[model samples]
Each structure stands twice: as C-alpha cells, then as structure tokens.
Target: MAQQERGKRSRRSILEAAARVFDERGYDAASTNEILARTGLTRGSLYHHFPSKQAIALALVEAHGEALRPPERPVRLQSVIDLTLEFARRLQSDPLLRASVRLTIEQSSFDCPPRTTYDQSFEAILALLQEADRHQEVLPGVDVQEAASTIVGSFTGLQTMSQAYSGRADLLERIGIFWKLLLPGIATPGLIGHLRTTLPDD
Candidate 1:
C-alpha cells in the first residue's frame, strides 16, 4: 500500500512538473529534460511513469476536464455559468489547466487527437444544457447541442484571446461578458435575469 501511494505521488509530481514546462514552452519546445529538472526526478523514474513526453501531454489533456466539472446547483443554467467562470478562475492559478489549454491549442506539436479535448468539453456542456432544457431554463426552440458547441467554441476563442492579451489575468471578466451576451439568446427571459454572469467575490 505504501509503495502504491508513493507511486501515485511520484506520478503526480511528474505530471505537474511537465505541466510547468509545457505551459511555459509549449509542447514542441518542452523537453523531458526540463520536466525532470523541474521535478528533480531521474530519467528512469519519469520513463517508468510516462514513456514519452507525448504520453505526459496526453495525460494532462485528458485530466483537464476535472478542473471544469462544476458542483450541481438548483438552477442548472447557473451551474453552467458557474462552470465557465470557475474554469476561468482556475486558469489564473492552475498550471495543470494552463498546460492542458496550451497543449490543446498547440495541437500540431503532439499526436493526441485534435478533437478529443474539444469533444470532451462539448459533451460536458451539452449535459448541463440538456439539464437546463429540462428545467425550462433554455429558451423554446433552442437547440441544446448546437448551443453547447457554440459555448465551447466561443470559450476556446475567449481564453485564447485572454491568454494572448492578458496572460489570462482578465479571463473571469471576459467570461462574464460572454454569458451576458450569450444568455439572452439561449436562456429563457425569466432565467436570463436570474443567472449571474460574473464570478462571486473572492
């Protein structure tokens, strides 16, 4: 049991160290050596856990969803809004998420399927939107799937622009603006007025 726990810790260390390198240098320029240096782990140890840098990148990309999963709320639409705001908030402090976002956009640097990250994001948002639809939060005739896709795509662009312009310092504010404009189109008029577009005060 102790050995297994240690292994888990070691793996987490490797992933986090790799995340720092990937976030800073991007996938193509990031090297295993830099990750090892960051973690102070030997080559053999890293290879034992992740055979290649691409494997580490894949693992980070897959784990990105964990950060975005919002707790359930009485108002499902609010939960969806909270999820986006939470993700933006996390990007400011979480290196793993930053690395995953960088890896996701720098798709050409790695062999991981280009659509996998986007598809996962779309599915998660779709589930939330479907729930919102059931709650009558969504406007009549609005296509939840299409709305989910738009949300994912728009967020992708929003974060990319935020990262470029502000290094994500203003991501939360940008997401607030996003929901303000988006809610009117997809959410019921009654629900739109109730949903909070901005992040709650920290």
Candidate 2:
C-alpha cells in the first residue's frame, strides 16, 4: 500500500512538472529534459509512469477536463454561469489547468484527437443546458445542444485571446463580459436578470 501511494505521488509530481514546462514553452518547444529538470527526477522514473511526452500532454488535458466539472446549483442556469466563472478564475490562477488548456489547443502536434477535449467539455455543458431547458430557465426557442456548443466555443476563443494578449491576467473580466453578452440570448428574462456573471470575491 505504501509503495503504491508513493508511486501515485511520484506520478503526480511528474505531471505537475510537465504541466509547468508545457505551459511555458508549449508542447512542440517543450523538452523532456526541462520536464525532468523541473521534477528533479531521473528519466527512468518519468518513463516508468508516462511512456512519452505525448502521454504527459494527454494526461494534462484530462486533468484540466476533470478540473472543469461544474458545481451543482439549485438553479441550473446559475450553475452554468458559475461553471464559466469558476473556470475563468482557475485559468487565472492554476498552472496545471493553464498548461492543460495549452496542451489541448496544441493536441494536433502531439497527434492527439483534438475533439476529445472539446467533446468532454461540450457534453458537460450540454447536460447542464438540457437540465436548464427542462426547468424553463432557458429562452423558449434555444436548443440546448447548440447553446452548449456555442458556450464552449465562445469561451475557447475568448480564453485563447486573453492568454495571448494578457497572460490571462484579465480572464475573469473577460468571462464576465462573455456571460453578459451570452445570457441575453440563452436565459429567460427572469433568470437573466438574476444570473451572476461575475464570480464572488476571493
């Protein structure tokens, strides 16, 4: 049991280190040596856990996806707003998550299927939108699946632009703007008036 726990810790260390290197250099420019240097681990140890750099990048993408799971809320539409706000906060503060986003965008270079990340995110948002539609919180004519896709695509473009121009320093504010722009079309007037576009204070 102890040996297994140690292995898990070691694997986490490698992943964390790889995330940092990948975040800084991007996937193609990121080097295994840099990852190893960051982890302070021998090549054998890293290879024992991740067979290749591409595997590490894939794992990073999965980690970010897991981090994005929305917290449940009594009002489903509010939950959707909270989900985007929470992710925006993480994008500003979390290195692993930031790296994961980078890896996902650059997946083509790693020969990874880009849709894996998008599909996972789309399904999560789609489930929430479907629930909201059933609750009548969604606007009368909105298609839940289509709305979900728009939300995902919008955020992806917004975050990429934010990262490029501001290093995500303005991500939370950008998310608020995104929600403000998006809510009018998706939420009923009653829900739109009450939905929180910004996350609460830290």
Number of the top-ranking candidate, with lDDT as the measure: 1
Q: Report the lDDT tens digits of candidate 1 across residue range 101-134.
A: 8888885658776657788888889999999899
Model 1 residue 53 CA deviation (Å) reads 0.8
Backbone clashes in model 2? 0
How many angstroms is residue 13 displaced in model 1 relative to the true structure, after the best TM-score fit? 0.9
- List TM-scores for all candidates, in order: 0.95, 0.94
61-97: candidate 2 lDDT, tens digit per residue: 7887776688889899888888888888888878888
The global Cα lDDT (0 to 1) of model 2 is 0.86
Candidate 1: clashing pairs of residues: none
